[model samples]
Target: MQRFTARAVVVGDRAGTVVPDAVLDVDDGEIRWVGPAADAAPAPDAETVDLPGVLLPGLVNTHSHAPMVLFRGQAEGLPLDRWLGEVIWPREARLTGDDVEVAMTAASAEMLRNGVTTSVEMYFSPERIAAAVTATGARAVIATPLIPLPGMPPLEEQLQHSVELAAGTPTGGTVEYGLGPHAAYTLPLSILTSAAAAAREHNLLLHLHVAETATEGDELLARHGLSVPTLLAAHDVLGGRVLAAHCVHMDDADLELWQEYDVAVAHCPASNAKLASGVMRLREMLDRGIRVGLGTDGPASNDGLDLLADARLAAQLARLREADPTALTAAEAFWLATGAAADAIGRPDLGRLTRGRQADLVHVDTRDLRFEPVGDKEDLLTHLVWSGITPLVRDTWVAGRQVVRDGVCTTVDAEALRADVAERAARLAHGG
Candidate 1:
């Protein structure tokens, strides 16, 4: 057993408790106890480590295309359709399994060093991505992209492969598998329904894009005589566990359908804003009791995989859209990147620092000038969300194992991975 005492521990519980001089006890990769240090009783054999900083639940990135780090900053300033069809897809066709592993390795290290331990990834080459996740000691829920394009396998074949992958996922590992049908505009009704059915059969989350752009919803409405959400519901595609990403163009009716289907939203505010996509109705979504989590999207689009930055952007965008500073509080925004994100992805054991939960946490060094004059709990939370603290993540722990220490990733050689990705990214960019 190991015991860690920190200056302050942000519980990230149901009540969003913050305890000063907190002690957290971990055994077998699970939290055994969490409370004030004055009340903690140390076991004879417990190894105690005292840290100087505030401890927080490791950030949960609800949506990402980790392998797309290879394509980061390639199609800058383009709309979503042109960006994907004209720039991304053509280059992605040349991606090999080894390229994906290299890109994901860099991405995993970057996220871990930035205090994100759990991520929901949607990409191709699931096995390689899973291998990269394991190598980096980062927990991930990987969804194999089921988009049927030229040079790609057939939809049925991919669906079957996804099922096999999900079934073959090792038990109690740091990775899980799911089915990802690209989106309504990219896939047919039959493909979407088939993916949903497969997800139900395998008991996997159906992760996909939904109502991302006005053009996507308009095209779906013109073709199907229904909105994207309604069409999905009519075809029984939303009947199972679903994580819809980039729900920026949804309406009241779409929100109603999502609520009825119990679908969670992965709000990628940074990517949306960068692509000139409209802001999501976050205030309305939360008011309607919808589950909303922060996502960094893909590095190719968002240009970074920092969930803390995304949380601040989400809150700012929500307030700007609603014209109310009180639309989303800092604590609430922080929750979107932590506990609420885990809940959105259907993992209750993650994203919180409490007993019986997975001991995935981060320690941020507050001695920096960014956190100067840190006051009470509310002030600290505000500083964390509003101030730039990404570089202050001194350490990150996932499942009771230290993946990052002193702002450096221990599970992977970051410099070597970056050097490898640079060559691959250049080749992919030049169409070599």
Candidate 2:
């Protein structure tokens, strides 16, 4: 058992409560208690660590391709279609299992140092990805990509592999698996419908990209005589549990369909803007009572995995799109990265500092000028959302295990990992 005393604790619950002079107790990888330090009375033999900073739930990234760290900064200014077809897909075709393992290892370390404890990963090589996550001690929900490509197995074979992975990795642990159908543009209607049926049969989360850009919607509508969402509805693909990413081009009808189907949206504001995709209708989504959460998309697209910066960008974009200063509050943005993200991914046991929740927390050093003039508990969250950076994270823990301390990752050899990735990335860049 262990107890941590901090200056403040941002309990990322539904009400967004904050406790000052907080004490958090952890036992067997679960939070045992959370309250004011003055009221805590631990056993005599328990260990205690006093910290001079604000404690908050570690950020949850609702969508990402973790192994894309090797492709970061490649195809710099290209839009989504050219970027994927010309740069990304060609290189990804040559990726091996070891390549995915090393890249995801570095990505896990980077995310942990930035205070993101849990991430939803959609990529190939699920077993290798899971091995990397296990080695780094990071929590993840990995979804196998279900797109058919040349020189690859048939669609049925791919689906069977995904189901096997999901069955082997059940929920309630540090890792989970799901089905990821790339998108309507890349996959046919039969494949999409079959994937949805498999997901329903296995009771797994169906994650995919949808309505990412105007070009995508235009192409789909021109070919199918219906919008992307409407086409999905016609095939009965939207009736199951879904986590749709990059919903930047959704219309009112699409929004209504998503709401009726109770689909969750993973809003990747930074990636969307970087790729020249329009901003999502965040205020409208919230107003319609739709579930929306924050995502970093991928290191290649966003060029960074900082969820705090992504939160700030989301708030700014929401305000600009709505032409209202109060379109999205800092607290609301913070919630998108934490509690709401967990909900979007269907992980109720994470993204909060409360009894029975996982002991995944981050300690932010508030002694710097970035957090100057700290007024109240509310101000802490505002500062974290607007001014927080990777350097502010002093310590990070996942499931009662301290993965990072004093701004260093304990589970990964970052220096060696970076060197290896540099060589591998160069080879991939040269079309080896």
Candidate 3:
């Protein structure tokens, strides 16, 4: 058992600063108590911490490539199509399992240091990624990449591996398993059918990149004579409660298809804007009451795995999309990153500071350069979303364990991870 207290904590919305000096007790990897410090009875056997910051629920990243940390800043300034065909896929074809482990380890560490507790990742060699997640103590929904490129093996090989990893790790892990079928044009109809069937049997979420760019949408329509959603629905893969990465190029029909089939969207604004894929009418999705969550896409695409930064960028982009300063408020963006995202991903108990939920939380210091002049709780939240510079995340906890403290990675040798990334980059640079 362990116990701690935050001087001031944000308990979701409308319950601002409920616990001025709040106590949080963790027992056997669960939060047993969370209330005022004066009301909490002392547990003599428990280790105690005194958090000198504002405590809030940890952020949930809906979509990312955790191993792409190795490729961060290496691929940039190109649209999603050229970026993938020219830079990403070529390097991806050469990566080994060991390379994946090193990269995911460093990525997971960076995510934890910035207060992200759960990640939904899709990439190659996810077994190595699962191992890194296990060692890092972060939660993740890890999906195997099913690229339909030439010389690639059949889906069954990766299918077997994904099943094995999922069965082995459900909880107490850095990641579990899910289905990732790359995208529409890349994966044939037969492969989509197989993935959909596997997803149904396994009861896992199928994550795919669809309508990410106008060119992709145009090509798919030219070849198949159907929109991305229509083609997938015909193949019996669009529905079944899946996570679609980008709906930027989607039409009213495609949007209506999501409403009928109940699909969640992972809006990656930074990635979309950086690649000039065009904004995906984020406000339009919200207005339709569609399930929308924030995603950093991949570190290579976004240049980092910082969820707060993503939330802030999401807010800014929403305002840009609507041409209104108050398009997406700070609290609303916060919900998108936290509770809304958790609910979108089927984790209702997550993204809120309450009893019986997963003991995943972040502590942010208000005494920082970015958070000065915090007048009200809403203002504090505004700072969190709009002005959180350099991460006030002094500590990050996942499943009742302090995985990162004082902005340092507890489970990983940060310096060694840095060196390992350098080595991988060198080897890949020289084609060794």
RMSD in angstroms between candidate 1 and the native structure over all alpha carbons: 1.0
Please, what are the lDDT tens digits per residue for candidate 2 over residues 166-188? Answer: 98775687889999999999888
**lDDT scores of the candidates, listed in order:** 0.90, 0.90, 0.80
Clash count of each predicted structure: 0, 0, 1
Candidate 1's C-alpha runs over 4 A off are none
Of candidate 1, the 10-residue stretch with the lowest lDDT total is: 11-20
Candidate 3 or 1, higher lDDT: 1
Per-model TM-score versus the true fold: 0.98, 0.98, 0.93
Residues 268-371, model 1: lDDT tens digits: 99999999988999999988988888899999999999999999999999999889999998889999999999989989898889899999989998887887
State the lDDT at 432 in candidate 3: 72
Ranked by TM-score, top first = 1, 2, 3
Which residue ranges in model 3 land beyond 4 Å of their true spot? 12-20, 36-46, 167-174
Model 1 CA lDDT for position 40: 90
